[model samples]
Target: MAGNVTVDRTIVRAVTVFAMLNLLVTLNNTPSRSWMYPAGLGALGCVLLTLSVLASLRDCFRPVPTWRGIRVLTYISLGLMAAHCLTVRDLSPRDYPPLLHACGVIILTAAAAFPLPTGCVLMGTYAVGFFFVRLQSLTVGQALTECLVLLVSGATGLLLVALVRRTVSIVSTRSDLTQQEARATARALAQARERARWDGLVHDKILGALRNAAAGDSRRQASNAQTLAREALAAFRADTHSDAPTALARKLEQVADALGLECEIDIKQDQISSEVLDVLEAAAVEALTNVARHAGTPRVSVRAVIGQAAALLIISDRGRGFESQAPGQRAGLKTMKARMEAIGGQLDVRSTIGAGTAVTLSWSHEQPSWLTVLWDVRVFAPMIAIGAVDVILNVGLGLTRPARLFIPWLNPVLAAVVIGFNIAIAVCPRRPRLGWMLAACCVPLPAVSVLNLVTYGDAGWRYWAAGALTPAVGALSFRFRSSLGVSCCVASLLVLMVSEAILGRTSWAPVLGPFPVSLGVALVGGMLRRGLDGATAALSCENVRLAEQVRQAAGIAERNAEISRRRTALALDILPMLELIAGQGPLSVSEATECRLLEAAARDNLVAATLVNDAIAASARAARGRGAEVVFRCADNAQPHAGLRIFRSLVEQICATIGAGSSARFVWNGSGRDFIGTAVVLGHEASAIRAVVESVAHSGLLTVTCDEDSVLIQMRTH
Candidate 1:
């Protein structure tokens, strides 16, 4: 797609070169013309051929060819070939002039350069005119045979160009699909990483401090609680600038001191971005906090190693460890894993009971594979089809008049060898050197064998296989380099000329008839390869650029969302509670318990605000009052904003089904097309909830599962 214009220009230039060669060959054989036409008419024919070549040259450089120019060139080329045949005077029926060979060049040029309808019209006009013109000099059967040869040439040209265009379109479509999938994957990962960061910040920093302060008992404990409150406030106000680089060792030391733990820190390399460093630091802090709370230890080790294009961080603690698959501990570990994965990193956690725990985070720059962008089967399929067609047509034509062959048995054998070599070329397109060798061995064998086997008397028709098979040399163009393909074409032309000279032919028209067509085909193939290569490179670079931009925008959006949520919590929850505590000196036992409940409610809102609408909130409050624990966990920010009316009704139904002394945990997971929400209920046997979940499932919007002690309801997020 990127180099379409370049490919078009390459095709036009090939056609122009073919026209020039045809014109030159026609002029070279003019003195040997057996027909007695006027000298002035011959000069006019020459002028038309020159004008057509010049017009083709002009079309080569322009983006779109002038339709009028194409029409004029077509008329002149077809008119000259017909005029040469019609104006014959005192010439033998079998002694056709050389100018008639120009018809093949004209038909091919029309097919390659003209629009489809116009090209078909021009080709049809040439076919009818040539048939009638040949009737003036030869019998109907011979005239029809020549007309068939000319038409086959045109059809082959048209099919080749059509296949090329179809393959280009397919490649473009595939490239677009690949880019779309890459962008979608990137966006999903970005959203997951942002969710992980926010979930950890809210759960570990804000909610943990609020719970501690509300449960404080002694005077020293209250002072410590107040300190935690101030620290939480400072965290809400803290902002990170990610446009600069960060030193890993210094950050880890500060994290260890803030947690009041003895930490052994080691740093090997420090060339990392601020964004990546932030993820590493947050993961390290979470690991250290886990050690302090669950590991029953105060000392830990933090190590970071950064390379030219990759980084790794490891946090280890020797304490009272637990099984890695413990149920309640997975939430924090899952958050850290998602955080690492969002930045194309991996997180590995290992622990043994009464031993230790180790968490490793690693990331690196990855490059896309070149094989995906370069080689395609679509391009090869067309080439193989065209090559097979060429072999079939030539073989069919050669067998048409077996009696005319000097040695019919030997001819088919040689033709088979040539076909086999062509097949070799088709199959070994990636191995150009080997293909060129096979092409060299095949080119001269066909030209010499076909020309020598068939007796030449009627203007080269008996040996038409020699010229018709010339396009087979062009098949090498798809496999070999451009220069090598052109050389093969030239070699085939030389072999044809030498074989024709051995047959005592004085004119060069028959020898040069199909050479220009073969050369043009080779040029088109070379241009196609170059165009696709350029397009692939451009697409790869663009994908890299787009991924970087998406990551940056995702980071900015994540920061902005976090800031907004923090501001809301400060103004409506934390700040008001702090003011009340300050005004009253200290909270009573009942007030502290109320504060804990309020903090838990705020935490639930931060987790899944979309799921906790006014109706759902009221229902959840009533369930809580009935001694039920209602929790919400959202993995990503895929809120069903457009389907809120439906979501609210469904959520309210599920909430009402919750009985006393029960527990419900609602979780939102996935993003984009696969987004879903599920609610797990335990500790109660409720037939009403099963009925409600099954009713929604029957409508195709939800899926319900029930166990002896629990029920799960899942629904798509819009």
Candidate 2:
């Protein structure tokens, strides 16, 4: 309630200033002795208002007004004003110039200090009393009109302070929520980078050696590569460093830029280990370097996708590609394979003689980070309620000395019973029914323990019920869900306590006395039932989440199997054809061209199976056939977000707008919180692409920027 305090200070300061000016007037009129009595009372009122200013200021200089003392001081100022109003018939004491106005300011200031309803009662009652009490000296107009103005002005002032307080409180709450969101975003990014780092480690060390061995023409060279790969895997975990996905993203971008390569980098998650990040970074650098060397025009695209338990990175180039098996040309690919093998990941390479090249790295971790779980805050509500009830019991114990003296053993026996149940609750690995049963057993403990104490003293039956019902109310409310039940339980508890005190030591009979207590206890039993239902609801929600996860996992597994089947079918088609061409003597020029085309298409199709979404992949293939160079990336989501409908539609429009030999880039879900639901599409014909969308009925908001040479289309869904 910082906002409340701030408004309070402003009110106090205003009243204080008025008091100071009033004090000056009081001082000027002091020396006249004829009207000493009224003059003396007026002086005291002014002095009291001034003292309120000091107390309010002192409260500010120290800490806060958590106690009732500061409130009492403000009321004292109000009281002196009421007394002065009773004594003096006019606005101020005979010669004192309008001290009542200053008193009015203090009264309103006091009103602001209290809650509105209570403050209105206090300030209005005093203001009305003053006006009517002084009616003997006041005109009818003065009594009615002047009193009305005073009440209205005071209420308006209070309203203004409350408005300021409420506005500040809302803004303060929103700022805290914003900060929490920002921190959560940062952690997600960090974890994503960690996962990427582990994948990278596999690429750099183990995969690299395997690639070299695969390219070897001799058994000796192949055997040496095997030895290196094995050694790298054996020492891989020991040699790995903490992954920095941010560093990796930055370095990859730098590598592309240094080579004058035109590229876009989209990394949505930084959830890989440091070692994996390092490996992936090295691999990305190597792939980009390869683009600079063999791929003409040096154009590349790098993207990283991180998920619940797995991650993938795709480094692609649309420049002129080379044959993978060409002498000394497969060095980078060999190393990538070795690194992937080293860290228990996989690397797949695809290159076409003139089509393009794409390097795909895929990995999954056995244990996902706990931060990845989406936990509900309400999961701890029951625990918080239980703990709060426990603390309240302890506090009430200290507050209760008379009850303890009545039955000296009452305190220790109840404490031991409660503590014993506490231990029982703690020892259970899971939330057990026994714990709820034990708590139910402990709820009536106060009345039951005091059975023997009834004869010891005359604190009355009210005293015993006081000990019982206070705890009964708290314990019942701990988990009670029904508003009606809680109200009834509380009402019954109050009635039982009062009735017990009335009965004194009279009769334990009279069914009415124990009737309400029984109803209250039954209502408390509903707490146990409510808790059980809540637990059941939580379990059901958890089951839904797990079921969804399982379904997604199964979909991914089936897709992986489908991809394996496609690769096998494609290999069966290409390998036999290549083997026939090689054995049937040196291939003719046309035969060699056919072999290269078959290989490139096969490789591209296989890479396409894993690295890109079908929609984007189909659009890319279509655009390529139309002679436009397009790079499409969508990372972080195995299934495209619903928000991407507008984005994908706009991207297709852009790809369609590109003239033959033109180029464009499409990026979705970039690295910042603001950019998460955003997609950027930029191209030389961007303006023409914007024109294509000018007549379309788009669902989300689109921002189109047409530069001199490039048109840019940005879509934001959230």
Candidate 3:
């Protein structure tokens, strides 16, 4: 704020400096034979300069509210200079008071135009005083010329100041807008860099291990490793790449290739901006990901278009689709929907689990340039069309009271249709191109009206008044466009003329109706249309939000259900083995039933736990393996404990179920007899593996692998 004040003060000083310079130039141009006149003029210049400096300083500390007194003082100084210029007898008529008087007038004009409060008043008053001092020496012609020149100069200066102010405002606004765009671009670049780093590290380590396993003649191990490797690779690759805003279709193609899925892209290029590209990219990616993961289909098609002031993107997969409205079924789908909305776009999904899924994203480009033109045309087009139609119908039913009474209502209806047509064109899925053609049609309508007016005088006024309502009605109906505002202004002027004709001039009353009725009709129609349009837009936004919420809720529920099913299967397998063990006596030695139950329970529990662990490991490996290095190791610490031998048996069974090749072991010297601190290695597939390991780690006994097989981690009983 202080900086702004400082800058403002600098601007005022610059203006004062320019004003003083112009004053000096005026003094130099003024001719005076006597040295006294020149001397007096120089003194005035010095005094003006001194006053300007002091005013600038004072303005910085605190602004002066009034400049009346300062103005009077400057006027007194100019009066002395003017007197000197007037009384110089040695100078010629053109050189003496006339020329000098013109100079004084210019200086005074600059003062008035400068926007310097105290300075302008002082300069203006001084100019007036100077003129007053020379008043006795001037003739009537000279005085008139002085007044004329002063008026012209002041007007010119004022015009320049207004132009400067407008230019500054425009430049400042543009600068601020550019800065905001720059900041946004920087943020996007940062996100892209972070994704690239994540992908690079995940791919190098996890997939490489899978390749080695396959080459070493371990086919069974290779297949299992490959599945984990593929998951990791997919995550890494997906994380690394992003869709460029303007080339969404291209990005979809890249993603399809990476996933080894077939994809078709059909998109229009014209009028495509980053905003449109982003919406399409989001919709296409989500749809394609679902197809790859769940559709059980190989092919996807994407189509995009820009038309009729709207943009559309559609993605369809030939994979298994899901229930259209099942609760908790589609989180990915819901996400795609939310993205479309933020940009004022809409998304609709159609799917059946067996058939395939199709997703459509649509949005209007909402061009400001077009809106302005549409507004203008909307107001006048229907108005003129309705008027032309009105004239033809009115003439057909000439001088009939019924025709006159019904025509007003009919005129508005036809006008409304014209407006509806424009709105349809604006909101249509296809881009509208009637811009030039609309202009062409409007050109001759006014000429035809003028010809009718010339042919029939008072009768023409009635036709004119009726025709005026066309533009007025059109303006009210499609006032969303800028064209409507201009049309309204033009229509208002026309109505004013009509009002004058009907009420002020009784001569035209026979041909025209009352002023109040026309005015009221125009006002009410415009307001009504505006209200309806606003309500419609608000409702559309609300509906989209509600749909998104419903989709999200349904998706959450479905995921929860899938988790429950998996847990139930594991529980059923473990429950029977536990019951058999309980049936045996505590001290049963080598009992076959007890031994079989223990073995079976261990296998069942280990298999269930292993499946869960491997799935988690695979998911994490996939995440880290995307564009990065990964490693896996098995620990040699699988042993049964006396008290919890079931738990130890479970670990061994789990290791076998998940396969042994992906494990790592570490030896660490401990002060105690407990070997639980031994390190066991997981995978270098995904960074998420760290999270899985940490989650399962217990204080008494657990796997801990850190520092590249050098350190041991285990659960400590404290």
Local distance difference test, each candidate: 0.65, 0.50, 0.42
Question: Ten-residue segment with the worst summed lDDT in candidate 1?
Answer: 368-377
Off by over 4 Å in 1: 1-7, 31-37, 40-55, 58-75, 89-96, 133-139, 159-194, 207-245, 260-281, 291-322, 341-346, 352-358, 362-390, 402-410, 413-513, 529-718
- Candidate with top lDDT is 1
Q: Give the least accurate 10-residue stretch of model 3, judged by summed lDDT.
A: 627-636
Give the distance in Å from residue 252's predicted Cα in candidate 3 to where it truly belongs.
Answer: 4.6
Candidate 3 vs. truth: CA RMSD? 22.7
**Tens digit per residue, CA lDDT, model 3, 211-246:** 323233444334433443454434433432323445
Q: lDDT per residue, candidate 1, 158-249, as tens digits?
A: 66655555555666676667667766766666666666666666555555556656876656446545655565565566654356766767
Cα error, candidate 3, residue 130 (Å): 6.0
Compare the candidates by TM-score and give the number of the best one: 1
| Alpha-carbon RMSD of each model | 8.0, 26.2, 22.7
| lDDT per residue (tens digit) for residues 65-182 in model 2 | 3323346555765676666555654433123223444555456545766677877886777677657654655566545544654454455445534544454455445444544554
Model 3 clashes, total count: 60
- TM-score for every candidate vs. truth? 0.66, 0.36, 0.30
